[model samples]
Target: MDERTRADVERAEAALVEHYPHLVRLAHLVLPPSMGRHRKVLTAHGLVQRALPWRAARRAAGALPAQRGPDTAAGYDLVRQRTLELALAYEDRRRPAVLLPTVPFVWGLRLFPRAGGADELALDQALSAVPAAVRAALGLWQLEGLEPEAARAVLARAGVADPDAALRAAGQLDRRTGAGAAALLAAGEFDPCTVHVRPTDLLRRRQRARAAAALAAVLAAGAVVAALPGGQPAARPAPTAAQQALDPGRLLRTPNEEWVRTSRVDFTAWPPRGRQAGDRRLLGRALRVWAAPPPGTRIVAAAGTSTRPPAEPPRLLYAGLIDNVMVVVFHDGERLVRYAEPEGATPTLHFARTDNADLATAGALVIGRGNGWQRYLIAPWVAGVAVRDLLAPDAPPHGLHLAPDGVTDRIPLPPAGGGPCGHWPATELRTSARLESHPAVLVTDLGDLAPVHLAYAAAPAGPAAPGEANGAPALHSWARTACTLRSLRGTGVRSVSNWVYARQPLPEGGGTAEWVCNRAETWRGPGRAMVQFEPPAAGPADPGRIAGRATGTAVCGPYGRGVLGGVRWQAESGTWYLLAAGGGRVDGIDVTGGVRAGADAPTLAVPAARDAPAEVTGRLPDGGTVRALQP
Candidate 1:
C-alpha cells in the first residue's frame, strides 16, 4: 500500500483510540443503565478490544509494502476476519437479554436458505422460511447495527446467501433485540446472563432450536389455516360483554336490537341520535365522571349559564389509557383535543387542541387536593401535552409541548420556593400579552402580580358577545393557580412566565381569541411591578382576595408565534435556576438554586426595552438581543 494509505489507517487508529470511551458510553446509554459495574466494564473493554483489531488491521494494510501485492491481499483478508470476529462478539454481547429467545431462529436462518443463488427468488425463500418474529429482530439487528454489521454478517453466514440479505436480516434481529432490551431495561432488568446467548453450548442450542421450530410450525399452521378456503377471515371480535357494557357506542345506542344491527353505530358518531333528553341524563348518570371535565370535551357553556338550547351537554371525544395514565379526547364540535392525568398534589389535566380553526388551542387544568381546579392557557404551537412532577406541593411537574416552530418545550414544574407558597419570585414575563386558545393558565405570585398570581387568562374580551371573535360562548377562565413562579436573584424580578398560545372562537360569531405571545422573560427586583394577578382565597370558586408580595425582580419578554428561549438566573441566596420557554408557553424550570458562581461567572444581560408596541426583544446569554416578538 502507498504511504498515503498508511497515514490514513494510522489516523483512523488514533481516532478509534480517542473515541473508544465515548463509543462505549454510547453503547451503555443504549443498553441498560442498571448493568453491574463489572458488566459495564467488561462490555466496554470488549467493545474496545473489538474495535482495536479493526484499527490495527487497517493500519497494517496501509503499512504493507507497495510491491507486495499477494502479501497485501493476505494482510487485508486477515484484517477483515479479525474485524468481523471482534464486531460479532461485541454484537452478541450486546444483544439484550430479553431477546435471547429469538436467537435460535436467527441462527437457524444462517443454517437454512431456499434456492442457493443470487436470484431474487432465493432471497425471497430465505426470508420467507424465517419465523416472522425472528426475521423482524434479525432485520433490525444485522441491517441496522443495533448490532455491528460484521457481527450480523457472521450470524447470517449460517444460512443466508446474499450479503445484502444477511445484513438486512441482522439489522432486523438487532432492532427487535434492542427494542426488547430497552423494554427490559426500562423495567429494571439488566442482568446480561439472564438474556445472554450461550453460542458455545451445543446442548442449549439444540434445545432452543427445537422450541423455536415448534413455535414456527405452530405459527405456520395458523397462517395456513387463515389462508384456507371456507375459513372465515379473522375479524376483530366484537367487544366482550363487559367491554360492550362499558363501550360508549353500546351505551349510547338505543335498546332496539334491529336498530343496533342496521345502524352499526360506533363511538365515532357524536351526539347519540334518537335518544330523549331523559335518556341523555340517564347515560350521563351511568358513565363515570372525571373530577375535571373530560379531555376534548369543550365547555360549550358553563355549568350555570344562559345560552342557546338552554342546556348544552358536555361532549366527550376519545378516552383511553396511555402508559398507565388516563387520557381523554373530546370536542365542543370546533376543536379536536386530548387530556392526560394531572401532576402533583393537584390532579391536573394536560390538554391539546389539534385543528387549524380558532377553537383549536389546547390548555391544561390543575385540580387541587381540595377539588379546586385552576386553568392554564397554553400556546397554539403546543401539539400535545404532558406534565411531570416539578412544581407541586411536593414533587415537581414536568410538562412537554411541541411548539409550532419545530422545537419541543420540556417544562419542569418545580415548586416555586423550597416549600409550597414560599418566596419563589419571577424574573420575567412575555411582554406581549395575547389571548390563549387552550383552556389552562399559569399563575405565580412573585412578579408583577400578587401571591397566587394568574397568567395566561383567557377571559372573554368582554361579556360574551355574539360574534366568532367573542371567544367561546361562555367566559370560561382556564384553570389558573397551578403554575408557580420562582424568583431570580438580584435581578429584582419576582418570577418568569411562559405559556402556550392559540386562538379560539369567541362565544358569539365573528371574531377569534387571538394568541398574543407564549414566551419567557425575567423580572429584575422585588417591586410591585413584579406582582402578578392572584386568585381568590376560598380557593378559586369563592371570591376572596388578590394579594401581591414583594418577592424579587420581574423579567418579561415575548416569543413570537414560533420561537423558544431559555434563561438561567442566579439568586442572591447562592441558588441557580434555569428557565426555558418556547412557542407554546412550555416553560422548564430547574432549581440549581443555591449554586455558586465561579470566578468566570456566566453573564446575563437584558435587552433594551422595545419602543414598538408590536415588537419585543429579549436579552440572550451571549449579551446579544433577539427579536422574540413581531406584529
Candidate 2:
C-alpha cells in the first residue's frame, strides 16, 4: 500500500476509536428499550467502517490476501447498502423541517450516498450543494480537525459571508447548539460514540455543558463582534438545565419524577419453574377462546336455558341489555370485530369497527341501558349481558358485581315455532368486577393489612395465594434466594417487579382496582408517584439484600393514570427477573428454588374453577362485603 493510503488508514482508525463510543451513546439515546439489540448496532458500525476504506487497517505483519473473498466483499456491500438506505430514509422523513434550502447539497447526497466512494466529479457536485460556510465548517471539523474559531477562518476563505450565522445554523452557538447537535446526530452526521453517554434522547439532550462553558468564556473575555444597531446583546433566551436534560434518547423525567433504567438478564440461567399439565390445559383453553374472536370484537354473553332442547348447542359469546337489541363480535380471526348498537325508538342498528358505514347492510340493534336489567339480542348467533342505565353518557355511577360462582339471568324469547313471544328470563355469568371508586379491599400475597404505606411489592409465586405466610421483616427472602442460587450455581440471576398503589378516589363512584408496571423509578412525597426501596446492606446470610425504609409514592401508570401497584424481581441461576405489574396480571412457573426466566409474558390458563372466586381476602375500606375478582 502507498504511504498516502497507510496514512489515511491510520487517521481513520484513530477517528473510529475516538468517536465509536460517542456514536454508540448517540444510538442509545435515539432507540427505545424494545429496539436495543446490540447486534444491530455492531452490524451497522462494521458496515460503515468497511465502506470508508480509510477506516480499514491491515495487520502490521500479515501477508496480503491473494484475493478478496466473495463472501466478505458481498457482506461489506450489503452493509453499505443498508446504511445508505437507512440514512436516506431518515433524511426524507425530516426533509420538510430541515430549514436550509441547499438543493445542490441534497443533489450530492442523492448521487453519492457514501462519502468515501465518491469520485472527484461527485465530490465537486456534493461540495457545490453545500454552502461555502458549510464547506469551511466541514473542512475544519473533518479534514483539519481545527477548533471552532480556526474552522471559522477556513470557512471565511471558502467565501462564507456570515461566519457566525453559519456556525449558529450548524448548532455551534449558545443554548441552541444542543438542538443543532441533536438534529445533526439524528441526521447521522455526528460521531455516534460521543453522543450516547447522556441520558434521555437526541431530541431531548441539550449541549448545555459545552454551550454554557463556551458562553461563559466568551462573556468573560469580552469577545464581541459586530452588534445589531441597538447594540443590545442578541435576544437569545438562555437554555435552562431542564431543557438541556430533555434528551430523547434517555429517559425523560416521568410525571412521578422517576427515571427509567434498563438492564438485561439471561433467561437460561434461572431455575426452571415447574410446569403442570393442568396449567398447560388451562393456558391452551384460554388461548383458544381468545384466539377464536378476531380483533375489535368482544364476547358479549352466553346462556344455557334449562327448558331448551337437550342437544348441546354452541355457547353464546355476545349480548345486549334490550329486547331485540344485541351486538356480537365476529369469531373469524381475520376481520376486525364489529359492535352493533341500537338507534332510537325506531329499532335501528349501528355497526362498529368499520370506516364505510354505508356499505353495512341492515344495522344491528342498539342496546340501550335501562334502570334495571334489560334484555337485548347481542348477535344473530350469540347472547351476552351488560349493565343497564350505566350506558348513559351522564348516568348515575354504579359498580359491576360479578358473582364468584356464575349467575344466570332470564329473558323472554320468541317461540321457536313462531308462537307468541313470552316473557322468560335468561341467565348470564361473569367472574370479574369493575368499580367506580377506590375500594377499601387490599389484595396482596402478603397477608399484612396494617395500613402500612408501600410503594412497590413483588410476589415470586405468581399472584399470592390465600394462605402464604407473610415473611419476617428485614429477612429479604427474595434476595437470600438469589444469593443461594448464585453461590451454588455460578450462573444464577435475580429479578424484581415493583407495584405501586395509591389511596385515592375511584373514577366512577364505587371502587376500582388498577395495576401498572414501573418502567421508571421516581421519588416524590406521599400523594405523588414514586418508588421506595431499601438499599443493599452487608449481612451474613445474604449480603446482597437491598436495605432501606419502606416507602410509597403516587405514580402514573404506563397506560392510564393509576397508582403503581407492585414490582417483582426474581433471581435465578442464569439471569435476573424483573416484573413490573401494570394493567394485566401475569403468571410464571417455578423451577426448583429459582424462578423460571422467560416467563414475563402472561400465560393463558384454563379459567379457575367455576366455584372458586379468585379473591384476595384483605382489609375492606368501608368494612362492607367487597367482592374481588381477577383482572
Worst 10 residues of 1 by lDDT: 365-374
Global lDDT of each candidate = 0.30, 0.27
Residue 316 of model 1, lDDT score: 51
Compose the digit string of candidate 1's lDDT tens values, residues 162-227.
546555553453343323433322221222222332233355346557969987986787788888
What TM-score would each prediction reach against the true structure? 0.21, 0.19
Clashes of each: 147, 113
Give the alpha carbon lDDT tens digit for every residue of 26-130 in model 2. 322222111122222332344344434433445457655334322343333223232333322222333333122122121111111112221322233233233
- Give lDDT for model 1: 0.30
Off by over 4 Å in 2: 1-4, 26-40, 54-631
Which predicted model would earn the best lDDT? Answer: 1
Error of 2 at 613 (Å): 33
